[model samples]
Target: MDKQIETELEAAAFRGLLTHLQNHPEVQNIELMILADFCRNCLAKWYAEAAKERGIDIDYEQARDKVYGMPYAEWKDKYQLTATPEQMAAYEKRQKEKQ
Candidate 1:
């Protein structure tokens, strides 16, 4: 495929992923970290970094709002759950394995 088509397809895929995540608030960030080694926050950071590379100035918070479909604080208050000890242990083990 050509570059433009590739870019459009990738952008569509990203939007789909963001929508899926926004709809599935029960999937905690910690679980994402343990299973995929990345989370919504990581996506926000990457979004910010990508904007910077393109000479845009999207800050982290702005990127987060876009990825999360709401302010991070509001999302946390409404959806984020306290991690269980088992979840924490799994996350820690994943971190160790990555090293």
Candidate 2:
């Protein structure tokens, strides 16, 4: 595939992922981290890094807003659930495994 076509395809895939995440608020960030070693926050950080690489001055919060489809605080208030003890333990285990 041409470079432009490949880029467009990747962009479309990213958009589809974002839409899926937005539609599934119950899939908490911690859960994503536990399952995939990354989460929406990771995505936001990557987004910000990419913008920086492109000479665009997008900050973390701005990237987060784009990924969350709203302000992070508002999204947290609306849908983010507190991690349970089990989840925390699992997360810790995952962290250790990463080391």
* C-alpha RMSD between model 2 and the true structure: 0.5
Residues 1-99, candidate 2, lDDT per residue (tens digit)? Answer: 999999999999999999999999999999999999999999999999999999999999999999999999999999999999999999999999999
How does residue 66 of candidate 2 score in lDDT?
Answer: 92
What is the overall TM-score of model 2 with all chains considered together? 0.98
* Model 2: lDDT to the true structure: 0.97
lDDT of 1 by residue, 1-99 (tens): 899999999999999999999999999999999999999999999999999999998999999999999999999999999999999999999889989
Using all chains and alpha carbons, the TM-scores for the candidates as numbered come to 0.99, 0.98
Worst 10 residues of 2 by lDDT: 17-26
TM-score of 1: 0.99
